[model samples]
Target: MLYNRASLTNEELIKLYKQMLLPRLIEEKMLILLRQGKISKWFSGIGQEAISVGVTSALTHDEYILPMHRNLGVFTTREIPLYRLFSQWQGKANGFTKGRDRSFHFGTQEYKIVGMISHLGPQLGIADGIALANKLRKDKKACAVFTGDGGTSEGDFHEALNVASVWNLPVLFCVENNGYGLSTPTSEQYNCEHIADRGIGYGMESHIIDGNNILEVYTKVSELAESIRENPRPILLEFKTFRMRGHEEASGTKYVPDQLMEEWAVKDPIDNYRNFLIEEKILTPEEDEKFKDEFKNTIQEHLNATFEEAPITSSIENELNDVYKISSPTTIAPNSTTQNIRLIDAISEGLRQSMERYDDLVVMGQDVAEYGGVFKITEGFIEAFGKDRVRNTPICESAIVSLAYGLVVNGMKAVMEMQFADFVSTGFNPIVNLLAKSHYRWNQEADVVIRMPCGAGVGAGPFHSQTNEAWFTKTPGLKVIYPAFPYDAKGLLTAAINDLNPVLFFEHKGLYRSTYQEVPTDYYTLPLGKASLLKEGNEVTIISFGAAVHWALETLEQVSVSADLIDLRSLQPLDTETIYNSVKKTGKVIILQEDSLFGSVSSDISSLIMENCFEYLDAPVKRVASIETPIPFAGNLEKEYLPKNRFKEELLQLIAY
Candidate 1:
């Protein structure tokens, strides 16, 4: 705590000390509530208060900070009202997450605080996105993102570091190495000499800080932040601290050695800072005692008030509306004239006109820039837009998707292009847990479109050509779109780009070049979740999307009965109205899809028809899809494995029955 520090006045020093003390007192009371059964859980940051307080006090309140589970000091230091924080703990309606999440799991926009998810490393990538947005806007604002020693082992840690350094985004990645990651010691977490050394490898600067020393941290981080904002780039700071409590209250600290606790307890940040203040005659002993008493009483007062607020009432209707925002694409501003194009060209031209229409639309993926995508959907994007908007990311799928979430957190919308749809499995956690649940858990809208080029026919085999719409259509928050033709591709993608929720747009590799249509080359969008009625007949109905629709189209012509062919442009927000009406009109029906039969979109549609339109059927429903096996590489095996061969037989059986 003793150093020739920066010129922080005695008044500012006392304020910082008090800020550190407030969270300690708040947690102390919350621990009491936990014992009394008023609160279910409490993640106490009792020992490591100085890092959050000191680092936060140094940065401007308008700049963003992503706090970890133990960083209550960040909220208090930024003057986030105590009542709301207490409400969060009690699952009250007034909390930031509307009681959807507990403890420091929620972040408040009022304080520019971005709360981290359970998987900590992803937030680091998201912080990079915020820094990227700030740099693009020339806001001169920097961000402070925190992670733990255990989090350093995640692939996202390496991915985020490399991206931030290469892009030179202004971010202070503060790692609180508290010796253990839930009983795993720092010795096992990494083999390096120091965590700070990893920063050098990423071509970023590094610093070591004493986590318990309030004076040292405030002065050092204040200087570090000023330097970063002036010349934008990332710098890593390793704060050596100790977790005085368990990971959460219930997970006891028995794994942490008694000797280690004794060593860190002696370096208590609040006790040390208060003693230094008294030594310098900056504060009397009476004032120190008074500050403690005041904080204790203030926290109790807020706790009592928090209990008075209503607890979140359970309601399915409330949750029904929570999963997605109502669609409104009219707000988009881009415009263009008409042109005839291939399905692949419509995709390219749609994005070109979309970028022209929407200034905030940023396209990012591996080899997407100069090389174009592997499919060339983003061809000439780099030349058309600058490198900043047309970003070519490192091969880090998880980090790339999370970074898009970060961009959308700011005002910008992003187009996250996966070189292949099968590769999305790498980013599943962030998408399903973070992006999909974002709107349902919180009111925030994730305005980004994830483009996945999928489907079989090019013999890309199991790893690349699989159509996995079932993976997302079942997920509540995401909109899954799969188009079969050129015109539908541009319209649905534009709608997805303009959508306020996270969207999964699937493009068929088979249809990209093979299918051609004269389309409106302007910025336009078709109805999302609305099926295109390609043909109308009274005998039987066929519902299909993506490449399988073409197969269904060809197969239905061979059948005796006239059929209603529905090209379902999107999977989720499934045009239930169109589906139900079509099924009622024609008693016999078949649901066709490129994906395998087991647990696929076809099965769900079968269930939907059975549940809603069961009595309308003259015969049993049929599903025609690929066989339930991994796609074969042999060309003949691949040809036999697809749904096209079965569709004609299935459609004729339904009509004959």
Candidate 2:
């Protein structure tokens, strides 16, 4: 007999019972494998099967979900092959991330599941993006993200909640209040009565439930999911439960009190739910035992097959595959006819044209909508694209970037902006880890353009004036584009937007309205990793990017010596062919950058010249860059700190040598 209130057929109840049992039994088998030196590691979700199974069963397959390591039931309920799960834990190549990332630290598109990163909170921000996508497309899909009681403490949690509430997007924040974050107790983790209280702070509806009761969890989540789909609002659900096992297999339960464990042991979700089924006459004890045996036997078969499969065999060549889907090498030349526009206007034109071209392209940032951004780069964007496409986000840099990654995960392209380049420190994790590494880890495309307004010249001081390109250039799986002229700015912005990977497009703040060049207005993409030869001569090679390229141009006019002046439009993929050829002919080179000398992009150029062009060198390679001290507010001191005054001196010395 099926429960009358639930309207669940006997088969659905039986299936839920089986789904919960499989993860528990599989974890038991995995624990044995871990001890026998077969699998490397495991995180046992022995007591938390119901939460995963119940919540996942409540939502439809189309609704996206982000889960954690303890969500083994989620994978099982979604009907992912048991072999893949076992193979994944064993780091096999057939695993979701091809053994690149272990456990639930990977997203599988087939299952519509995006697993969490080690840093718990960012997933919530990604949830916001997925929810926003659903809202814009009118898909009636409520996005859900899982977190522990401890994960609610992350700033991303607050940021995501606020945005979801403000925009009335369809999202469900599911917190399995397992009473501990690692070894930290709930008493120590927060001062609130429940994680659900955070919902009140965000003006979102909140609920608490007995997580050990599978029927209650299923009923509540089903109702909430339906409501979110209908009304398109965010909700927070805090399921109060206990961690009957240690956080992971290696961490023992000693940190948990003996009394607490004894209390929760009797309330084990699977055991209680089985007893309830027996009371309803829906299942018999003999049948429950039979079900366990059947699941165990099936799990064993998959485990045997998985273990027979060879573990991941890796080498440098294998590991290096798919780090990035780099921007294709474009051979098409721009239109011969052009109009003069400022560097910032060129950026605006490129963005406008791309928006006109791709309907799904989204532009999001702070003060970017009605206010036109701090520098007015996004002026009149709302009027052109409307609010859905042109979104003005909260001042949360970290979540904003992760949100863009979330959109990319759901088959949409995002162009996010940082108000100031120096502020990128807050959002570095998503850029370097999620966006940059997604393709390499799980083949998830994070096709995002993060526009960074960088460089020094105006007396914006340390917070606003910074050339932080070196940080991203050193990171693999990222394209760093820094264009010095308005033409390259418009052309490369088009290219960065077209790239299938994450791109950090650096716009020198000083050059936004300061310089102008004739640029094509139509949609066109210049080749990435290609540098422009502004002036070609043989006495010296003066290579620079961003604002310093202009200074190099001016310094060339001061000197009588003929030099090869090259502007690096893209930083990560260096135009080495152009640099090497020029270095061989010029024999002497002086690298210029607005960033500090040590550990800068210029440092890499200097080394490359010495290594590849050493035999042809006429003098030692010199570097002109900012002083070691922080940028000062005084105009004169700022000029002294930068390469504006130093590039000419370095070029003259190289020429004299």
Candidate 3:
């Protein structure tokens, strides 16, 4: 053993050195595999391994890490098994995700590392939520999130920093400034002198260091990590480094200058650090050679073992099985009485019941606390649950959504409300990309409910009212529900809160007080994915959801046609069996929708009828939907845009046909 050391002993320094070297070697092997068509793609931070090792080494084992794809040294520092990494690259059954994901896309709960998505910038906000959980537990733990200079340009980067700063979360923001974001130089990307400057703008104490120096990287990060664990404030750390290889082996270095590559290659982190170890006599030349050889041989053994395994096979049934978690039915109390409640009040009651049931349930969004949400759906919740459980966030929608995802993954439940469904565009990334894909990707349940107040007839105009259910219907992993009645709204919201997956619960703004009924006062849950048969008829089947269901009911009374009115409470996991049977019985169908005609849910249901009930149809399926245009602000134009008259005319036309 050697004696002279700075901050870390000879053993630890040597260990860090070896950890950095192993990833470089593994990446080199991955390149070979790529050429042989064994692996699909490769992204390497060849010259910047010191940042991952230095930062991750400072974190305690259980403190979470939201690493980017290039941070392979983090997995090494955390002692992730090399064979498992190899198996993932080889698409073998022994991989962490059982070959469901590829390289840098598998996370292990045991390691506290979140598997990275392709769009990595959003993870910074996710890390904030993980840190928030630790803070809530008062566990004195912290999180370190990795991103690149290019990633800093993403809106999520700004949104995350703002939320972390405002919440005083214990998050270590590590930005690796590799000079380029997939060939776009930093000069062209941003006007700021340094990415760390942006963090300072968000109220974080910022630092910049030479990423090539392992000792400097470790010393600064270790100090800040401990400081934040004690005081619980975010720290922004910038590591200036260069990517020593192609973006991937296939995406060649033609765009990168040879002179610059040669300059950075000579300053390769592993080679320079190895020299530092030998020059300081921390390791003898012979010891260094033996260490490199041993690691290389171990990596070779892992590769061989991983390649010998077969790829995991998947059937359509297996893939679909994980789309949702099976919920045990909850029986409503037989002695409970129905109370006269508005739709909005019923939603508040459901929130109260779910929060009272689970201590870890969190309610957060703009104006949710104190202000009781814009629609008053969470009125009195802050008084009942306290500010700790019901939080009013800044207008950072992306952070709100992604942070909820982070909380759910850590065993807490979250109900995030979008003040208006139109603004969901701000948080669309996490909803579709992260929340919806979490279960399908890693069997990780994001027990999150996003409450959206939707519809056009509310006269809230374009920015506040939009029927965007069609957007989520295209996404596979989300459960979309739009309830028309107070009872259905309360029941569906309760069920969504208890579900072990992400759910988009759309509450129609127009139906908030336009209709009221007796709703169950006690805690209960309705089955998700089942439609309610409101009326029975024989001539034509009228199917709809949300505010349009009521319109269909009213139109049925005006028309002199016999029809069956079906309220489709859930848009996805569609009650297709109910719809098919109804169409078969009626022999003619009219699907009503409040959303625009272009790319509407009615088109999908119409197609399903055509595919399954073609022989039973007496005429072509009819769709009554709003005109394909932005919602008009004028009351008269808005009324004209609705399809109420069209529904009656379509019913008469289909009857005649």
lDDT, model 2, position 164: 87
lDDT of 1 by residue, 1-657 (tens): 574446878898788878888988888888888899999988878989999998898899999999999899999999878898888877788787776887887765668888888988888988888888888888888899999999999988888889999999999999999998988999988999889999989999999999989888888999889988989999999999999999888998999889999998888888887888888898899998898898888887887888888768968888788889776767333345566678999889888888988787789999999899888888888888888899999998898898898898877889999989999999888898788878767677887789999988888788988888899988889999888998889888888888899999999998988888778756777878889999999998888888888887777666666888999898888898999999999987888888899898888889899999999999888988888888887889998989788778777777878
lDDT of 2: 0.87
> Ranking under TM-score, best-scoring first?
1, 2, 3
* Runs in model 1 lying further than 4 Å from the true structure: 1-3, 331-338
For model 2 the TM-score comes to 0.97
Local error of candidate 1 at 637, Å? 1.1
lDDT of 3 by residue, 1-657 (tens): 122246687788888888788888888877777888887888887899989998998899999998887899999889988988888777777777756778888677889999778887668888988988888888898799988888888888888888899989999989999988888889999998988887768878899988877878887788888888899988888899999877776777788888988988877888888888888888788987897788889988988888787767988898788776655656454226889888888888888998999999999999999989888878888879899899999998988899998888777889999999999999998889988888877778888999999888767777887889999999989999999999988888888898888899999888888879899888888888999999999998999999989888888778787888899999987999899999999999989989988788999999999999999999999898998888887888888888866777887988899
* Candidate 2 local lDDT, 87-203, one digit each (tens): 887788768888888988988898999988898888998999898888888888888889998888888888888988998989989999998898998999899888898898889
Q: Per-candidate RMSD vs. true structure?
A: 1.6, 1.8, 2.1
Better of 2 and 3 by TM-score: 2
Which model is ahead, 2 or 3, in terms of lDDT?
2
TM-score of each: 0.98, 0.97, 0.97
